[model samples]
Target: MQTPSFYFSRICNALKLAALVCLFLGTSPTWLHAQKSLSNELRAASEQFLATLSSEQKALANLPFDSEWRYDWNYTPRQRKGLPLKQMNEVQRKAAMHLMKAALSNQGVAKAEAIIGLEYVLREVEKRPENDTYRDPENYAFAVFGTPDAQQPWGFSVEGHHLSLHFTVVDNKVEFLPSFFGSNPGIVLPGYVQEGKQVLKEEADIAFRLLGSFDEQQLKKIVLSEKAPNDMLTTNTRKVSLEKREGLSFGEMTSAQQKLFQELLTVYLNKYHVTLKNQELARLRQADMNKIYFAWMGDREPNRGAGRGHYFRVHGPTFLIEYDNTQNGANHVHSVVRDLTNDWGEDLLKAHYEAAHKK
Candidate 1:
């Protein structure tokens, strides 16, 4: 029997193969229009998860859909407002994971779990006590903005150290953006149970490949600086704007480089379930690719063995993707994908509210 790792490792290849099959068959994936089905599943899983929670837990897990806190998101190991896994019992924890599985693709779920598990490695490296609570795998908090309903607008988020994932559903359409996935001890060294584990390895490696393919002239267009930023430029902001566009646009890339760029994008987009994945990819495909920009900073090489820092971002009309590995001697990584116009499902919410007012 093949393990989950086997399938996880094949995500990029599978995506490429799926694209080829789509082109050959002249039909979209069967799950392309499965948004409503996914919405129903999310509703059911959320209901079940809520059912397992006590009254106190429910109070913490549920929030008004219009609450300002819905936009309050972070990937730091700090106190959060949602119901943490540490507060859940065995049954409740299982339900929580079911909700996660409902919202994320297998690859996305694996990355989240792996990021959480890194707490153990970090604790060991820091020589923390066995009972230390600072570096904890169970601190991830789950919060539901508004009740889960099929027709009404609602949202869900699961966040904690190195992970902040948000999803919003309205009128059967789902939006996933302003999503963050990070890794500390990004590459686990030897002397650990899962040594050499890099949860966000593809996110880093793909960009490296694209950068290496560029010639000196090509590099000048994309490379922003020799020093990487200490953190994401847009760190946890509620809104994202496309300011002065900088870096190399897709129109400038050669055919081969463009292929690498698209593959790099698929690594992030395919993290969602097929429905959301196809929906977002279709929208991006329809956008003007010439306007999409790729910028780089810091070391040309990744310096995998604790050396210089590096950072890059893919910014376009509809979305933005930022990746940074400038902390902890470039051993920690932070990557996020944000929607420029519809983050937190603002576009849907605006339309929903506007229609209601008209009614």
Candidate 2:
């Protein structure tokens, strides 16, 4: 029987020929048409959600464009500073969800909902009280920053336990970064709701498959250490900068390995709305893929029931993707994607401020 890599290699060879022809002819990918109007869609959704908020709720849900809270995000199960679903009426909560639907793709929406629902699983596993608000799914908070305008700069965030998502828009372009999604009891054990399920299964499995195909020399280049980090190296930091770059470069990979890496990245990128995904995908296609690096630590193989302590990161010039499963006997997972230059719309805001100062 042929290995998974064999199939990937064949597929990649076909894509390479088509990609070369497109590049030579200066033609764009078909996804160009998919970028119809993410900015307008987001503005409409934000407006609708805000309209449902009562005056008191608006007081908490709305803030200035430059508010410090715009960047204050966390994925821990703690009291957050936004209008939570628990405080919103059914109509308001539905609107809030609509806003999320506008920002995330179908896959992303499912993951977001699943991550929220995991709180119930946690409540049962931890044996919390019926009235306990600590693990409440409704604890996720939603907030909009500045006014929603088609041409103006503004942002929004929905953050809570195991999830922190942020979106910034300037003119008609949207920037989403520092996005996080996590799972406790990463694999749902028997007797719980959604038993024997893993929301982030693809993330680990795809990576493991790629690792498994590597030879001893390839493993030495990628695996940094035998012990994994306790959490993401850049956990919720206001600003992140990695002084040292480590791991195996994409140029070093075989054709099949490169295809696997691209597939792994698509799993993360596909979480966003198509417009955003296409926009980013276009940038990636034009980027120097050889600069991208893949690094791993801890177990070479995945141990399912109670996971093995493992971590991996895809670091490149433009972005960083990190995944760690070291807590809860390695059954808890923390994964995040951070934009190197534009977390919290750093580049966009900078340009806006410069243009403002000129006038």
Candidate 3:
């Protein structure tokens, strides 16, 4: 009856004692007023959507709103939201989707209406010819760093292809860690599965019931360096000192494997914001839950679906969560959550932009 990480660990202990005075006046006035009000409303909706482009639509609908277009995913977030809806026309793509629905959340406005339904699957399979539909969810690019209005610190990202989202709202108290949620043809079968079936499969059935409560040599010292480690040990690399917490340690499991590893890392620290998912499970209960590691990989056999032996991963110390249906057979899924020092807490947004814009 009460789970979703036990109401996200009781709303992360009342939002970590309501941000204990900017965590003892260290910074965050609501992330510098949601990063100066979302950098002045998406830089004035990217300067009125680049004053209605037409120098070849301002060299193919401009860019800089995002750095390296959120690590380019070979396009298709509706051709990156049609490069600002093809350089904005319908009143500047409804004023940049009303400044991204006033800074995201009708579930981030259904991820920009699923990138305009992936731009009608790239204008109906990019005019067929064995059409791959020339993928493009605008490579899922959208960024607003430091300024919106709720907690003075701000970030909203919807990165490419299979999509990733990161949300931060520090001072007002809401941060969804190193958050990345992915799906590639995760069930877009008959014309967008009519918005019903999203097959992450309870993110791989709660990590195969927490790695079937580990035992075979505690799942071989947390199944390290197998395959799934290429891109997210908080890939944004914040300095947990890249690898070598040397896997497996929830005090070396078994209290029913630490209650299925705290109900599968409280489904990724409660997908954030119950006071930073209770100050990251009170920092894994002050680093003593018998250390903490619950790793698993490539088809321990789940209807052998995550493809190529269907991989899985989960790491610990204030969290890292991952899932892969190994390409597409397990019905394509990629999951991510990291707080290995608040990534995109980009060093707490460069120490609140050097103690308030070091003028």
Off by over 4 Å in 3: 1-134, 137-147, 150-155, 170-178, 181-216, 220-247, 250-291, 299-307, 315-320, 329-333, 338-359
Of 1 and 3, which scores higher on lDDT?
Answer: 1
lDDT, each prediction:
0.87, 0.86, 0.53
Superposition TM-score, candidate 3 onto the true structure: 0.35
Ranking of predictions according to lDDT? 1, 2, 3
lDDT of 1 by residue, 101-204 (tens): 88788999999899999999999999988777789888999999899997689988998998998999987668888899999988998897689999999989
RMSD of 1: 8.5
TM-score computed on alpha carbons, candidate 2: 0.90
- Residue range with the least summed lDDT across 10 consecutive positions in model 2: 24-33
Write model 2 residue lDDT over 1-359, tens digit each, in one string. Answer: 99999999999997995675454322644432233267788899999999988899999999998889988988898988779999999999999999988999999999999999898899999999766799999899999999998657998999999999999988666888989989987999899878987999889999999888788898898999999999999999988778766889999999999999999999998899977775665556556778889999998779864556999999988889999998998899999999888898888788887888899
